[model samples]
Structures are given as structure tokens and as C-alpha cells.
Target: MFCERSSGDVQKEDKSSSVAVILCFFGEQQQGGVSDEAEPFMGSGRFGKSPTSPLHHVKVVSSPFHVALKVNFLCQLFIRLWPDGRNLQLHFRSRLSLPLFTGGKVEGEQGAAIHIVLLDVNTGHVVTSGPESTIKLDVVVLEGDFNNEDDEGWTEEEFESHVVKEREGKRPLLTGDLQVTLKEGVGTLGELTFTDNSSWIRSRKFRLGLKVASGFCEGIRVGEAKTEAFTIKDHRGELYKKHYPPALNDDVWRLEKIGKDGSFHKRLNKSGIFTVEDFVRLVVRDSQKLRTILSSGMSNKMWDALIEHAKTCAMSGKLYVYYADDTRNVGVVFNSIYELSGLITGEQYLLSDSLSDSQKVQKWLIYTKNWFDFDH
Candidate 1:
């Protein structure tokens, strides 16, 4: 027999002819009394004998040896007398961005996803519908690094004991989907992946912690959610990672002095300049003949760090416009790799004079400098 209701619900009553009550889990903490007048302890075979039914005085404080641990401790003490008794947390509704490589997968920093909520710290609600909204949490891998300006006045047991420190020796290994259930109180965290590489730590940074995972009876009293310190590296530094905007068929050694085969990637693949849209169509048609083909083994600061890392590639607005025939004199505006965008000039066009012996402006400036070895 058991029943607790401040609207936290937990009921189980059957009183078959008396003597069923049994509260000795340390005699309700040395008789702090929750109402009882003695007489209850009859057990003898099938722990039975129900004849006149009478049991109804159970205020047992702790040893719930079953019935799912007394319905998980009266649903975590009625979620600390819920509704307004404060206390409840697990925040990180997203925050863990940056180049986190190692074995890869953890995203955000423009990739989004990585949630985990639950909150309620005195009505800032989000405990969505009670019993801590079907808890499950977990996601570990934390070690030190936190200071939102010293987390202003802390205290949810100091941010749930500030991620109980973990990483020291062989730690990293946090494979994919490290548990996640909660639905209305949020959860997300899917493809986690870490597998080592905190770059020989000494605060090379790393953090993620969550909690509440153990036979799910998470009866509230939440509080535990880290994730802000990040750095994973070494998946061969994601092939020299640094592609904020870069991506037009990537791989021109992912920019920055193009090192895949080094020496400015063998002089941009022996000058045919493979991908990154063929080095942004030869740096928009002849950046001084692509800096005279890597200025003799490159240097003007490595050709301005490979033309500021191929000007952070992200072009492809798909425009074309070209005109020279009907005398619109010049109109040029290329893109989608024809590069040059916008140059119309006709009021007695001069464009620095010599229209190179115009055969229709030298066949539209040799079809925008052989728009990538032009075949069609």
C-alpha cells in the first residue's frame, strides 16, 4: 500500500483484511513520525493472510527494496514538491561549436544541433509536463573549462558539481549518440563522435557532461549540464581544416597555401588548377597570370596565403550577361565560374583604349579568357 499526492501522483492500495503497512526503513528516520500508531508486522508464508483487511500507515523514508524502489522514491519526492519548490536543471540547449575533429561528427558553429534542455529553476519552466518529462540524459566527456564570468552566483550545487572532472589519461572515446531521450524537455545530441585527440591536454580544452542516466527513475532534482569548452583536432586536422565559405567542389588543398601535394599543390596541378572551382577560375581570370604561376615557388607571403585562401570561395550566383556584338560596347558580368561580375561600359567606351584589334572585342575577350579550357 502506498499513495502520495500533492499532484505528484503515485498510488497502490489493496488492504486485504488488515496488517499490511511496513515502514522500518530506519523506522522512518528514528520516528520523525509521518503518522503511525503501531501494530503492523505479520508476514508468514506468501507474506500473507488477508482476512479482515486493515493496512494503511506507510511513511517509510528510504529503503525501497522494490516496487521499482517505491515508485522511484515517490517520483523523486514529488519532484521536490513541484510547481514552485524551485530546483531543476540540465541546460545546454545548444553550444559546442568549432572545428572539433578527432574522429569527427560533433557539429555546430554553423552546423547547429546539440540540444539538451529540461530546466525549471523556479518557474523558468521547460520541465514539460511532469516527472521530469521522461528523462534519460547521459552524454559524458568533460574535464575543466568554465567561466561565464565565473558563472554569476552559481549554486545549483555549483552547476551540478561543475561536470565532476573526468579526462586525464585515456579519456576521449565518446562514440555516437551517447544516450538521449527526453522529448518535450528536449534532447537532440545525435552523432557525437570523439575518440581521442585533446591534443595532449593540459587544458587543450574539452567539455560535454550531462547526467541523469540510471534505470531512469529520474525523479527530479535535476541540475547538471556542461558543454562550452571545445577542441578536438587530429583527424589529420581534418585535412588542414579552414573552410568557412570555401566549397565549390573543394579540394584545391582546401586553400591556404594549398598543401596537399605542396609547392602550391604542384603549382596548382601543373597549372590546370584543379577544383575550388579551378582556383576560382584562375583567380577570376589571371590574377597576374595566377601570380605568374606561383611566383617562382611562391612567396609574396605565399602568394598572399594562396590569395587569401582563394578569397574564401562561395561563388556561384549564376549570372552571365556578356555583350559586345550589338555594340552594348562592354557589359561583362560572369559568375558560376566565369568569375568577373559586372563591367558594362558603352558611352563611347574607352576601357583603357585599345580593344585589342576588336574582332568583336577580341571574341569577347577570348570568351572570358578561355572560361576554363572552354570546349563547347
Candidate 2:
């Protein structure tokens, strides 16, 4: 016999309450107005509920069939919320392991390694899960002909773009400031120095571009020397000093007088004919005559003076002469006559005797002979 307990207490001998009946009553009541009333209570937080928690009414409807249906609905909702769950699961399941090379030294070798750390931006977590999620470090020591102009012909646009493109999808791998050491001998000719001033590399993704730019060694600051000295030496191991002779020296002759007098003197002087000009004019006018006289009996001093004057005027390239022999053999000559004293004296004597009446005529002829010559 089953006897239900009334309001206060029940004897242990009459404890026969059925769990199924209690569940049936709760379900019937919840399906009625109790469910409607519990809807507000579900959101009221009275039961410490959350969005992810099962609904209080639904929890009460805990039949095995309904529970299975709720679980299936939850799974469908989860799949809809995260469609890439399969891929994410696969990525997490197949973790990546990278090989590391510790620092080491070899004899007669210089080397360095770049340490890289990759992180997930969304969660600030180390991205060590997938095979492709890693930082690849390549240690490449580039050596080539630095003097090749082909490397130096980068346009401004190409340079800027090179940097931008390299850094398009990379992050900084360095922390502290970077120091550059440019080996002097390793650079091209006229490279300024082996050490460059310290600079900051804001990002490491652009390091390749920075390396290219730095390798170029452009826009370096140059310092001027306060003073410099140099010494020159001859093959004899003797230090040589520069010696500059005076402008007008002992070797050069100056004109004291041009000619004897009158129109010849006036013409000579007017025509810029100094003593050198007069002497050169006479010799060049009658080279053969002067040579004959010198051969006959001329003083060395006079010959020397004539020779000197001829050389000077010839070197100057300004004297000219003309004359005619007894046979009417006309000749025109352009030269200095200082070297032919015999010829000059002979010509002068002939002219003086032939035109003794007109000194002016003889002088004029001499002067004209000195300039434009027409020997006939």
C-alpha cells in the first residue's frame, strides 16, 4: 500500500513517492502556462543563467529524445558559426617543428645569423601550429663586382618601390638599433670609408631593401681635411724643388736702337722694328750676300750678333726680305737676317753706292725689303 505524506511529515514506512509521476507533473505544467512564465525568468538571471547555458524550460523537458534533438541543434549552430572549423582543427592537429642552428664559429670565417620570432596578430600567440606558419631565415653573404655601373643605375622610383614591395607583408624582426660596418677594402674605388654612422631600421621586413640601399653607399657625409702636405722626389732619390725663371732673363736681348737715322729709322720704329727687327731684316734681305762677305772676312762678333738677331726674329716669325741679282733673278724671302752679317753688309754697301744721291731712297728700299720682299 502506497501512502503519500501530507503537509508536515511522513513515516518512513509510508515512503513510496514515484519519480516518474513527479516528472510527468513538471512536464505537463511546463507545457502549459508555466513555460510562458519561465520564459521571462530565463532572461531574469535568477538561476545564474547565460546565453550558452541550456534554457530552464528546455532543461526541465529532459526526455531522452528531446535532449538528443537539442544537442543536434547546438552542433548545427556551432558548424554554421565556424565553417572553417575543419581546417582549423587540421592545422592545430598537424603542428610544425622547425630546425634551429645555434651560434658557432669556424676558423678564418666570418658569419652571422638572424633570429626571427613570429606571432599571431589576432591573439598575440606564437604561431607554431601549422607547417607554413614560421619565420624563415636565410643567411646569404653576397659578393660581387662593386664597380659594375649596372648596380648603380637605380631610379628614384625603383628604389622607393623596391623597399615598399619587400615590406608589403612582413613584420619587424629586430629590436635594438642596427650598426653597420662597411669594410673599406670590400667597397669599390673612391669609397669613402669602412664605417658608416649608426642608423635605425624601423622594420625588418624591409631589411633586404635596406641592405640594397646601404650596400649602394649613397649620401654619405664627407669631412674636409684642415691641412695637407705632399713631397715629390726624382729618380735619383733627391727631393726636387720647383724653380721658375724670371720673366725677362739674361738670355733675352733688349733693343737699344733700331736703325741709323731718317725715314728708315722712322719706318722701322713705326713698324715696330726694334734693333732685333733691323738686324734680322738686313740678314734675311741678303742671306747669300752676307754669307759671301762672312766667307771673305767678317768679324766673329758681327757674325754672332747677326746670327743672334736672325734667330730671334725667325723665332718671332715676323721678318721678311726681297732682292734682285745682276742677272735679274728676282727672289722673295721671309725670314730673320741676324745670322747673315756678310750678306747684310754687302747689300747695304751695294745700295749705298748705287743710290748715293738719295739716302732716303736707299733707306726706304731697305725698310721695304725687310717687310714685303720682291727680289727681281
Candidate 3:
């Protein structure tokens, strides 16, 4: 029987038989309950031999019988133990490469996707070999902008509590595929969307956390893997959101402060301005008329947002030059509903002589069209 001491020493309870004990950085051996040469564990000396070995402390406890070996390496101790007279085995408790989440800011309610992979912090490389090659990951939503860098020293219960607070005292309802299986240490979280917008607060944002699935975390110690804080706009806006360089046929409600069947939409519709084309034409032809239509309820900021969105509409490539038969003084250039006369001037008068004759009008129109296309 042996007993571990508080000090850095080992002693046996039995005093009758003589015993010799020798402990090495590589392994330990026993002769008459002790040995002069240590038995090499795992066939290697990772902790090096004595004098240079980091193995500074060894303790043996009896009754159930176990040996606790502790070493100082990288500010952390590598602990190994032998229990219940079992075969000597080495357990490496060293830090491992962690999984990381990568992808730019997420677009909420858009079925956004993100990526995850095992990363070697020491080498700064994506690790695809070993147990990380193929592993299952479970993702959860976390509170963004929370204090405590990268959630260090946080427990599972603490994380869950924070998540509950983040989603307004309710656990976030994450929909779509959340369990991702990696191949070559890389996996994509596809078609994942949040059921609720981030909490309404100043600088409000949300984060996603990833962890190894229960059965798959056997050997991998995946440290905190989370995304940067990001905002998620209400999903309702998605239906009215307009793409850049919007098509001419896009609805008026796509503009800011304009909702379907709302006051702005009703007013615009009453004025026969239904599509973006109609709105653009009315703005070009009668600026005050368009302003007066929405001037009652819309604010300057709202008007700016509306105009900015409308400006992104692409004009028809086809151009037409129009003039009155009575006089060449009046001329207008139109590309779809957009009046381009403001962009080009004086040149129209030069082609007036050819345009004046009614019989030659069609012929000169083609010539004018070709000239404008070539020049501009």
C-alpha cells in the first residue's frame, strides 16, 4: 500500500520489505514495488529525461490505488494517471486547434450560409487531417456584443442563459439545417435562417456559436467558435426590398416609406403612377406634380430614400428624338420615360432642317438615332 503526500514526494505504507522507486520523465517502473529504470510509456519520452524533464511532481494514492503525474509545459500541466492496477496509459491534455466560423456579415432572413473549419492557431492554417477531417457540429445562436472576449471561461449553462437573454428572454428559434457535418474539416451551414430579428437595442447584433456534436466530440476539444456581431433586419422588409439597378417594371412600393396599399402607394396609384417607369416619367415631365402627390405625408428623409431607390432603375437602351411640326424650336430627347434633353442640347437644332420635311422625317430619324448612338 502506498499513499500520496502533500509535498512533492512518494512513500509506501509498508515498512517490512525494502523498495526502490525511480521516476523518469518518460515513464515509471517498479521493482519490489519500485524500479531503478522507469518503464517507457507509449514508447516515447515526450517530457524528456530527468534534470531537464518538466516532471517536477509525482503523487501516489492507495486504497483504490492511482498515480497522478503532473508536468509544467506551456503554462499548462499534462496530466497522466494509472488507476486500479490497470495498464499504464498516457493521456495528453494539451490544447488543440479550434474550429472557426468564417463568412462576411450575414444577410438576415435571406437563407444565408456560413462556413466552419478546424484551424491551427499556432500555425494559422486550416487543419484537415486527424479527427477533425470529418466531424459533426451543432450550431446555436448567441448574444452579440456581450462582454468577455470570445466567451472565455464560459460554461454551457452560462452560454444558454446569455442566449435566452439575447432572444428577449426566450431561446432563439433557429430554423433550417443547424447540424453540419464537415468533410476535409470544412462545412457549410446552408439555408439557415433566424426566426426572429435581433433585440431592438442600440448597436444590436447577433452571433452564431458552433460546437462538436455529443457523439463526435470524443477527442476534439473545439474551443469557442463564433461569428462576429451582426445585425438582422426584420424579414418583413424583404418583400419590399429592391435589387440594385432595379428593372423598370418594379413596383412603387419597393421604394422607402412606400408600402403596398399604404397612403403613399394609394396617392401614387391615384395619380396613375403605378410602376417605377410611371414615377420616373412623371418626375421628369412634371416635378412639382410628383412632389405634390406625396408632399402631404412623406418627410424629406423618406423622400430622399425614395428617390435614391428610384435612381437605380436602368433606362431603356432605345432612344428617340421628338419635335413639333410647327417649329424646330421645341425638341426633346427621350430614352424610355427618362428625358435626356437635359443631358444633350443645341445638337438637335442642327438636324432640324432634315427633320423639317415631313417626307424625310423617317429617314432623318434613323440618321439622328445613329449619330447620337455613335457620339454618346
Candidate 4:
């Protein structure tokens, strides 16, 4: 369980598209009732999701302090009594954020982890203790491409049901161990950690969801709770230092520094594509035309590998950074390659009108061009 210092409120950078999507997920439904002579579900605390819930019934939130870079990992669990008064509502309030370190190493290399926080929603307090159970909590990570928006994108029904949808089209980026142990027995508070070492997490968005199997509730409730879609952010300095690991920082880091044993390295050097930065420009600029890239006597398999290698280099290579006085520098460059990568697609989603479509396109071209200059 986090302390009161961590529990206090912290202001966060504003995100346009997702801010509203979160509100639609928790659901605005009235606090339904629970029957069978309600008693504390935990050792002795009151549960949230109850209007008549004792002072203990309130949503559990994260410590207010967070960085402006990555998405914040926060969740709210609601326990409500159903009209039958026999079952409780296992509702989840999930948050989503993408924490990419500027000029740092891979985001998922160490693996993505989430702490499942259980709370007495009726009470403002966090559940410090774990209840005994044979069956454990299950954690699932789901993702979508919010950057790919449409005219009617943020509808309430579709956004709210994203987690619970049992349809086959669902794209789950990664699934932790079967039967996640939500109650890690950390202490008075019940907290559990689930982690995934998936390679694709770098480019996609993430959300955390939970399920409590049957009989664990001792015939009380069999349901789940989920956090709204959110990713966590590490400060620039904190994140910048994570990139020096040897495994991820290999030959792809620089064309000039590649091992001399390979013919590919020799060819690149002959062409004067020495540093990783130079090679990235060649791949990206040449890739604008498939024929141009393939014209270098490259086989189909070799061409694909080349682009993939370039992508790895772009993702893993560390840039030489120095403190500057007045020259403008862009820290993070956000782009949606979802279409090329076949990530989540939304045909009916709404697009933000803060800028005209043409104006947005113009700004994108200028930004990409500027990025190329800075890297070169």
C-alpha cells in the first residue's frame, strides 16, 4: 500500500483524446444495492461503490506525484451490492499512458509491470490487507490506437465496454501468468505485481484489467475489476539513464561501429553510412520508394531485414545529447505508424478539430523534416 504522501493529489499534463474516454469507462450507473445483511468483505473495512457505504467506501487512487512524460498507471476498484444483495459489483477504473524515455533505451526490454491495488471503494482508504483466497486475480493487458481517430470515435457505449468485450476481434498485446496473484501479501494492504516481457509493447498503448475466479470469494462474488487505459511516465533523467544496458545496445547502435565480420557492415561502410544516424536517414529516405530501396542489389528478405534493423537502431540507439542555450530542441516525437503496423483501427471515431486538417498535415511535415535535421 502507498503512504499518505503518495496518496495526495498531483497535477498531470493534459491529454486531449483520452481524458474523456476515461470518464466513460467507470460508468455513471447509480450505486446499486447488495443484500444478505451486508458485512465487511475484507478483514474489517467498508467497501466502495455503495452510497450507504460507511466512510470507508471510496475509490482508491494513486499518489498524486507523476511526471509529464509517460501515461500514469492508476486504477479504481468499485465494490457495489447488486439488487439481489447476494453479489457485489466488480467494476474496474483503469488508466492508460505511454512512457517512452527520450533518447533512452527500450520500454519493454525490462518488461512492463503493474501493481493491482485492491480498495474498499465505499471507504476513501486503500486496502492495506489482503483477504485469504485459493483462486487468485487475473491480469490482462489490452491496447488500442487512440491516435487513429474518426468522426464519431469517443462514443460512451463502445469506450465503456472496451475491457469487458468478449468478442474475437480483441487484440491483447500481452497476458501475464494465468491466475495472477493480486494479493502479494505485501502487508496490511493487498497489492500484487504482474509483468510482461513482450517486444511489441514499445509501439502500442496499454491498459490493465483484473479477474477474480470463482470459489475464491467463498461463494460471495465471482467478477473482475479493471483500470482505465493508462501507461506510466518516468522523468527524462530517470528514463534517460535506462538505455545503457549492453543487451539492447548492440551493433545496431551505429553503422560505423558494427562488427567487421559481416558483409552488410562492410557494404554500409563502403557507402559512407557510418553512424547509426546516417543509416537511419538512408533507410527512411530510401523507403519512400520500394523500388529505390530494392535497387541496391538487395533480395526481398534482405530488404525487409534492413528496414527492421533500421527500426531497431532508431529504437535502441542513444543520441549524443548536451545542454544548449537557445537552439530549439524537440524532446519526444510522437507519431502513429499504426496503419503500417496494423494496430487498432477505428473508422467511426471522431477527430479533434483544434487545427484544420491541412494545417495539421503541414505541421507534421515541418516537424518530421526538423527531426531529420536534428538527428543528422
lDDT of 4: 0.36
lDDT of each: 0.63, 0.30, 0.53, 0.36
**Candidate 2 TM-score versus the reference:** 0.15
Q: How close is each model in CA RMSD to the real structure? A: 14.0, 34.9, 12.5, 23.4
Write the residue-wise lDDT of candidate 1 on 1-376 in tens digits. 3422222122233322212332322123343432343324434432232542232233333444554565665445444445357567788877666878877789756788877788777778787766577788888775556444565334445555545333567554787788898987887888987877765556777788777887764444566777678778779878777686788888788877677877877887888878888877777767898888777767798777767777777876776656655656756556677754445566543332333445445546746654555441
Q: How do all the candidates rank in terms of lDDT, highest first?
A: 1, 3, 4, 2
In terms of lDDT, the poorest run of 10 residues in model 3 is 74-83
TM-score, candidate number 4: 0.27
Off by over 4 Å in 4: 1-109, 121-125, 130-135, 141-176, 184-208, 218-249, 252-268, 271-376
By lDDT, the best candidate is 1
The better-scoring model by lDDT among 2 and 4 is 4
lDDT of 4 at 266: 60
Instruction: Encode model 3's per-residue lDDT on 172-261: one tens digit a residue.
Output: 457667788877777776555566666464446666777767886442245546666666666665665555556678887766578888
| lDDT, candidate 3, at 99 | 15
lDDT digits (tens) for residues 1-376 of candidate 2: 1111222221111112222112223333333333333344434453223542233222244366765654454344334334333221001111111111111111111122322233333454444544323212221111112212443233434434433221234332222223322231111111111111111223211111123223231221111101011111222321121112211111112322212453334554554444554434445556565445334344566556546544533344434434444542332333333221112334343323343445445445545555443442
lDDT at residue 213 of model 1 (Cα atoms):
86
